[model samples]
Target chain A: MISPSQVEVDRDKGNFHYDTDYSFDAGIGLSEDVIRYISEVKEEDPWVLDFRLKALKTFEKKPMPTHWATEDLKNINFDVIRYYLAKGQKPSRTWDEVPDDVKNTFERLGIPEQERKFLAGVEAQFDSEAAYSRMNEELEKEGVIFVGSTEGLKEHPEIFRKWFGKVIPTSDNKFSALNSAVFSGGSFIYIPPGVKLAQPLQAYFRINAENFGQFERTLIIADEGSEVMYMEGCTAPKFETSTLHSAVVELVALKGAKIQYVTVQNWSNNVFNLVTKRALAEEEAEVRWIDCNIGSRLTMKYPGVILRGRKARGEVVSIALANDGQHQDTGAKMVHAADETSSNVVSKSISIGEGRSSYRGLVQMPGHLKGCKNNTECDALLINNNSQTDTYPAITVQGDANSVQHEASVSKVSAEQIFYMQQRGLGEAEAMSLCVNGFVNDLIREFPMEYSVELKRLIDLEMEGSVG
Target chain B: MNSLKIENLQASIEDKAILHGLSLEIPKGEVHAIMGPNGSGKSTLAKVLSGHPSYKVDGGSATLDEENILGLEPDEISRLGLFLAFQYPMEVPGVTIANFIRAARNARLPEGEKVKAVDFYKELYEHMDDLGMDRKFTARSLNDGFSGGEKKRCEILQMSMLSPKYCILDETDSGLDIDALRVVSEGVNRMRNPDRGILVITHYQRLLEYIVPDYVHVMSEGKIVRTGGKELALELEERGYDWIKQEAVA
Candidate 1:
């Protein structure tokens, strides 16, 4: 009998890190001078420079958090991380105009290809040009502004000046302070009132340097009666030395508007990813965060929403996977500030080998708010005896007229389920992959169709050799 | 040439014997039914044939045609054209029925070959239609939250799609209603051909009424003690298995 031919493996994940010579490098380490050098290099305004120095002070003054924290955070040597590095080139509008180094990434990825492919680089180029041209023209006429944060600050200060750092301030968290001190390259978007974009704006970011830090600050504001979805992807090349990725993303959904932010981050096992993401929703506005995490040595990300206006709603659906010496600590936070607000958070995690995953969450509704509701669901799937998972949720419901429902479940791959699939002709590995895929299927389905397919393939690749 | 031959099969679960010196032969082109009461090892035999990890085959020689499948993995056995319509089909959440069955079908293809999507979906839709399952069910998770009759019908839908050379329906009628039984029986009957053999395991003659057997065997205490034609099932239904046990002693 002929054995099945080897299906083409995901070479991208394996060779994801080959250090290309950088045109410019800041070397290694962080200092006040390093922060000043970065702001000066970016040619920032005095207000922004002052903002950076203040955030740097906060970063230096705040002690590393130990509460529900991983020791990996303490392992981060502030002195050894390069605060910033850029190739000294600007983003080109057309594929032909892009420099050779950056062009290599998106030569075939197409000009109007959703921004995620350019930033994420998780897979090889796959979108057709005809499909891009058909949609790019329609988006241009809708008063939707999608650009880099640098360009947004330089060109459209009217939109960026007020909303930047408003949702997540520099001192909100230690990592947010660090990011505020040296942030670069994240997307900046503005949607005018009553305008809606059909296609999601996408951006991709990856780090190739070891012992380096990538700090990206993304700000998106959807005006009243407007709707937009922004998605970004993050993947870094693997290295022996530790790398740090700290990002701060702030979003504002104005009255009667909706904004959905989706992130699929798969960093190398040696990277420490600490990110602060939060959204402020106005009256009758809505915001949603769909997060998928697959690989990292340690990741502490809790995408949160502040329901600040009446009848506002917030939702977060996330799935995290941890494998062999990896830790993924992620969850959601919803702070209800107005009456008649609603929030929902659904989180799923899978731990294989000695990998450990945790869900740390907070849901709060003050005593004065009348008729607010929140629902939280956390599910964990362990693939082996050595795998571990934990869930810590802090929910405070003060006074009356607030309802909260929380459900948490931890499960192993069912032996009966494995045997059942086997009886139908799937091998042990195939059976395991199917079960793992099934475990996160409901949440993964929430992703855009193109991404859901690649995400499943990536999950299948991780499940290989997962059988013990 | 299709024959499921088991000789002096001795199997156990956790060192405790279940099947003691059981022997059964099912040849091609006929439906053979095995009827027994609870704890008679009917399900054990099915599990052992499928090479379930829990069961230890102490002494057994089982073969599908020329190959000895006594110790092969369940997937290997399935690829070799042996299908078991489980008594309690598993619930696989988030795995669509279309993908599950497609994966199974794809397992049979040679290296690097893929099952054509059009042909696969056409065949799936045709069989699902014949089984009276909604087209939407194909996209739904496999047997997840399905009613008992729905589960039994799904088993038959799989059986019809896979079209194995030798099929052992392990209590396929246990949870099925009369309408479901008739539909499941018809789906099974549609696959009856000269090159295929079917072994139906049941506790009562109710299912046999819809899917008639050419030969009937009464298994008592883990071994087949009596063999007869179609009339034997009716007689056992009327007289009960106790008489058969007493008759065996006499």
Candidate 2:
């Protein structure tokens, strides 16, 4: 077995932090000054700075959430968070050329090795900056553009500006407003027309600084007749003082194109992971969101899809595991805006110890969108008596020809099942792990093979100390 | 010395009586078939012996090799040489058959002892082959998306791998077709040993044709009404359970 220290070093370097200052004294509130400071730091064009300023105003005007899953929003202090922190380094094109500390972090996280072995491209982000970004030469030659969002802005402004914040606008939600105001260091991917990338492009995000908010914005566009898969892995160090990670991601699948976005968020219990992700599917296009949330103090994420064209399809497969002092509130939203649109949302969550998990989803079809169909299934597993899980799914079908089905169930690991496993010679913990694994195995299998293995290992790690 | 003895065993579910004054014994090297109609406490007996928490044993004692098994936890009972193949095997979604069985096998070893993966898979494949299970089933979740026959075969496969001292199979043939029944029975037959006792519980005697129990006990209203050799199963099958109910009343 690989030593935990080795695995820690390999997995921790890029994203996991150690012993950092916890003072939230940086009173960089959501203001014009902070937005200007960020734009100045990035040395953005005048028009980009104007965009940031407008977004900052939007952030200030938006009120804290007053709707569903808003109880935890009270703890977020917008004034105390450092909007942006740059280590003063340009993004490197090669892993070896990256700075030592950042390179060591990615090395520890095994980012470079994973990129070499499995990924067609990799972008390593440290705090508020992209330390290293690379694309397979063949992919670049094939007109596939994968780069950090900042670089994409500078290099391919036309493509970047067209889809940026389009799917999820700044005023869409309070978190999206915050992300648009001070977003930094996320991937911008564009698959050219009719180009198909077999291998996934991955991005690794690491939160090393303390009392800071890492807000990154990502936009991916799969043009006509193209297909691509993008995977993201994120983690943060355990800290007593709360750290914030807010991100906004937007995806566009043009006619006859397909795109799948996969995210595995494994933040420490001290980090607050609040993200907004959505995609738009055009005629005959398909979009899929494969998301897994394993660790966090409080996480609120719902990846959604808007079916904007006839015959469009969308799907979201997600698994959320909350252990101890954690709360994972996640689900998906599907809006059928055109005729014959179809969507499926399957989400499973496991709550152990005193942790709580909730599934909140929505399926909406307008009266004019005939032949639209949606299916939503949400299941939760409680590992212990103290754990809690809840599911709230809302479906509205205004069209007579539309069909929607929703099913949800919450159950505990029965003592009989545990005893049966033990009788087969499994210990209590092993049996519980098997049950939890079985509970979410269907969704995990939907991930890429390598990611599926990592997910199982992560689940096993969380299963530790789950049973007493 | 060779039996799983239940001396006046009494059990209940939700404070209601289920198995009352039930006493039976199956000795090693023998297969005892317990036949009963629905709600006759046949399934309850299997669960109670395996320490299902829903059932509370209020009185009497059950012993494996003279060790008081009543006070022990279910897992402890299982580890102490008893195995219960559930009639409705729970679908453990993400857990593969190979890993599930391995974890069970690992539990039997001393602390810090590990099972060699290669050897474990080799053994698993061999057992799966004997059960006529496709090797792909090892990669699939335990009983998830499986047919009734597949689930029963999986239970038998687990039994074969765990190799318990005494095995209690609950309604193992309830949902199987003729072909699946034969395959599952063959898996159980191969696991029979001189040192291992088997208790088969079924509503019908059709399973006995393949498993060939050494003894057959007709249970009515939570107690063993009559005990006979293998011929009793054939007789029960020929006359049906209504006759047994009439005899119990008489």
Candidate 3:
């Protein structure tokens, strides 16, 4: 088995190959012609083509965000972005069948090894398409439908048509509309009723093509009495010019079912990672979102949950690390729409150097709901004097019997704490890292074993040279 | 050479004076105990000697074997061979005890040198065993979720690993029961050596019974009011602080 520490070292080195051979025309922006061209290139069905066209119209009608915390959206220059770039490769079923360059990329990222050791299945996506996808025989025999979204649309139209865009409609936001219009190369998982997958299904997304936007649409449906854990890992080669990764993910947990989704997003510093992910929990169903955001130039993601059935539960455990020139504006949103529902949201962020990390969350208990409860706690640690952090949590409790609580705190690595560690012989930087690691250790423990180790190493790497 | 000395120490918190004109010296190969009542500035003296930022030394000085330590940072003071086992050890959430001590040991090494993982773990396990700490505690966060006794043992475990020339255990026996106090004292006793000096701070004489000190000093209102042999602790425990207060007033 590959040690998680080694993965951490490799992630810090970030020596992934940037495939310069692939190039696409960037002047082509979002348009009906572009949508039709994408459909033609994918050989998509006529109905899928019509859906893309309708989404393109919605994308055009929606206005840019006027109430976001930052103003970088005004400079997006959508016309300069290449909405879809296939990189001239079709999805392969076997690792050996994949091109050497693409396979080597996944190998360096430790995806193939992870698949063999612990993952029940694996899907590796490069740029705009899944270059390789596979499932273990045991899972395949059990009738689990795990494939790339595009393939799912083609093979299982019945399941695809019924739930696609239902959780997050095209008009949800400007970025969601854009993703719906040009989405490609994400996972589609359907766990059969009453069947629990023993191991997590994993996917790795990489952006090796420059000036390209990766809009992968992922949808997971856990049927009644079923349980499954899905993990998504993403990275991109460092590019001088900014790349955009705007994807939308939707999850549905049927009555008495449970779904746990884990995401470890470590993009290069030159990418803007703006994603919208949400889930719908039915009667007595449970949904959990465990997200770790470690790297990006600017990231704004809030994984949300809507409790639609009585006695359903929703939870979100998130950790964000923002270092030099990065802004991680992330949190979770929970809406209690049914009676006797409960939700918990715990968010921890660490800001180093001049980085800024903010938590913006919402919890609403409508008047129709009775005996609902929601609790949110957002804590931030600033490593240095120049770093900054903020928390903005909004909780609206309308029902008389509902309860809501919100707590937030921001603290710096105390000089005395560093001195205490240093007196034991640690240098200033090592002491600061230890204190910061201890500050977020509780949240890190919530992650899978491998991810928790990798997250610590990532923090250590970002902490190097952080103190004078 | 392994001795700690404080000369006419004057310190304050937030510019308000606390420890004023206090002088004490502890020599190597001996254990000294400081007994005091509430608000006697016992904790502040420990913090100032370790260079806690909350306290500013407006005047006076302290030294660990000829090295002026008042100007150095708390960590620097520790690295210079003094260790303050905090009365209330901060609960460091994500850092395991092994890693925390390892970082401390690594800091002591010259730049570019690294500690071998195998040797580090071996040493940690041995010290943990000596302190009667479970091997699993090495993997747990430092002092996080630890009982009062377990926290004190953790401090002793750290003191053992660092092997400081002068160890100042601030209120080491606070909140400990009879069994826990004995276990913690045994851990400290195991580390007793001719090359080390220990200063144990406590309110009750029960701790001194197990980790008996060579000398005992009664501190009242930031100054050492009286100094005597080990029997001083026994006398105070029997008669209480009123006798010490009467002596100080006289």
Candidate 4:
């Protein structure tokens, strides 16, 4: 467990790193040999190794989606990026047993303190593997299984093999294929039926190696009548050359079950964060995604939900902030396949300096589905003249009984408003921050208390030097 | 020495001169009123003193208690104990009045020392009641979609809460009915103490009846052309501004 005084955790202060001396390092570039090396090192089952080999072929066959994505995607040279780097294969069950360097990094991130305060379980992943993973004794007694992906695959093959690639397959997209080929260190959680955890399970992903690509695969399953919440945070030190982070997260909610997934990623401007997250909800089940993206050079993520059973509900609440030299392309997607299914999406974005932000949403209700309802609202705030924002919503509703509503708006922080607040004793930056917070006030209230406070502080730090 | 003294204040906006070498003084323990016609630069004076970015001060020396405030930022001037109640308060959507005022108050406190929440709310409610405002207004957005009279009362609410050394009310009486005028005037009158100075800028003499001024100055074109006592307001209301314009030309 780490103390509060040992950490100076400012995600924007990107100068922190620990010396790396990994015993296993699969040099640079992507090849069958590299994938084989990773599978061989993990001692994975033959089927899992076969899956990786096939996914590597899929990754090689697909091209970068530069037609819709930013041209910056072309700048990434896959041949030079280190595919895998890890200290060891297995994660320690206790913090004291972890290596000193890895433990120090997580300590500086305040993960142990957070675990002690509110988290029921914690997994701190340093690079390609988790350094420490633990859950509460009471939760373990309740048959809740929480561990890193490596352990989950080897130890709980019966459950893991059932829903491993059922929700989001490797063929879902190019990034998903890439992730499936060389993925490591993410959480695999299973909440037993009728067991409702009071505290959330947390995972912290830290990218410590330079010129490295971190691909973490996460899967969460909530059984019938169970409820669970999972949160993940990602950060990396600034590197001279750009780094890559492509992760795949899939969720499953059984009948009468509820699952909430929250993510707050504040990567350095030198990292490209592209992730795929989706959830499948059965009869009377609910799934909610709360996402906040603060820092990244280019981030393209659209968390989605597939409503598969009657009376299933889905929701997505997202807030993205793009500062100078950053592009945050994010939104939500909902696919209704059952009668009486419903979904809602609310997204807010702030663009400062020369940053650009866009919202691309997709909502579909086929002709067979009846009594389906979908509502989406996206609002954008531009802080400077050079800031840019865009929205592209694709909605297809066929059945007359199905309905969809969408609203979007773009607003700027006016000079007069800033002056008026300044006359009331607020500094220029403070005034801007207040207006921005107010713009996203209604949506921010939905965030938890701890996250809302941290979000406000992060916005204040980004608002500095925003005004002349 | 303890006054808001302006000497040869020259100002303009967008290359168009609005105030041509205007000057006035409002010392402590006094309230002054400036009556002017349309485009007479009365509003410009309020903006110039508060460091509005649109208005440029070509040449002037405005001081508060011997500290020059011409080149200071708007927030700096505000922290120096000067408050401006805008005629049209900009609407800050989603920012509740309570939080907005609390931020202003927090800015005045020393570092790391915060206002007690209970005591602050108590004082705020009392002030809101004095202005005849509903207690629920504290939770509403700041001046967003508020009625004309409600906006005026909110301005007065902020003035009383800030309790600055000098207060400038720009057209505070405009767009208000008689009943609202009285409630707003009472809110201002409560802030009238020996340690503060108030400057009221209005186009008509209607507001002067409720909040009587110690001195009255008539502004024509860009500068003050007549100075008198409170009786001058009655005279102007009877004769209108035509006579004052004629007198200033002569």
User: Highest TM-score: which candidate?
Assistant: 4
For each candidate in turn, the TM-score is 0.89, 0.82, 0.81, 0.97
Residue pairs with backbone overlap in model 3: A423-B75, A438-B94
Where model 1 places Cα greater than 4 Å from the true spot, the runs are A1-11, A18-24, A105-144, B111-136, B177-179, B220-222, B231-250
lDDT of 4 at A467: 72
Q: Please provide, for model 2 over A1-468, each residue's C-alpha lDDT reduced to its tens digit, 9 standing for 90 to 100.
A: 001111221223224554433222223666787777777777788888877778888877888875666577788777777777766677789877987777877888889889879899988888887888888999899899988877888889989898887899889988898888788889999999999999999998888877779998899999999999999999887767888999999999999999999999889887889899999999999999999998888999989999999999999999998887889999999999999999999999998778899999989998977899999999999887778898888888895899999999888887666766766767677788789888887788899999999998888888776665
Q: How would you encode candidate 1's per-residue C-alpha lDDT over A1-468 as one tens digit per residue?
A: 111113322325533444355545656676778777777777888888898899999988988986658777889898888766666556655555544544554433332354434332111111100011112545557767777777778889988999889899888989999898888767778889998777677766657557788887889899999998777777766678888888899999999999988888877788888999999999999999999998878999999999999999999999999888789999999999999999999999998877899999999999999999999999999887778999999999998799999999999876777888888888988988988888898898899887798789888887777763
lDDT of 1: 0.82
Per-prediction DockQ scores? 0.51, 0.40, 0.37, 0.61
Q: How would you encode candidate 4's per-residue C-alpha lDDT over A371-453 as one tens digit per residue?
A: 99999999999888888999999999996999999999999888889999999998887888899999888877777666788
Model 2 agreement with the true structure over B1-250: per-residue lDDT tens digits: 9789998888888888988798888888989999988899999999888877668998999999778898676778888999998899987767788888888887888899989999999999999889899999888887779999999999999998888899999999988999999999988999888999999999888899999999999998888989999999889888888988898789
Better of 1 and 3 by DockQ: 1
Model 3 quality (TM-score) = 0.81
Ranking the candidates on lDDT from highest down gives 4, 2, 3, 1
> In candidate 1 chain A, what residue range of length 10 has the lowest lDDT sum?
A125-134
lDDT, candidate 2, equals 0.86
Mind giving the per-residue lDDT tens digits that candidate 3 earns over B1-250?
5479898999998878888789999998999999999999898999888876667898887888988998776668888889888888777667898888888887788887878999989988998887788899988988779999898899889998889888988988888888888888998898788888999999989899999899999999889999999999999988999988987899
Report, for all candidates in order, the number of backbone clashes.
9, 8, 2, 0
- The candidate that wins on lDDT is 4
Real contacts retained, model 3: 0.71
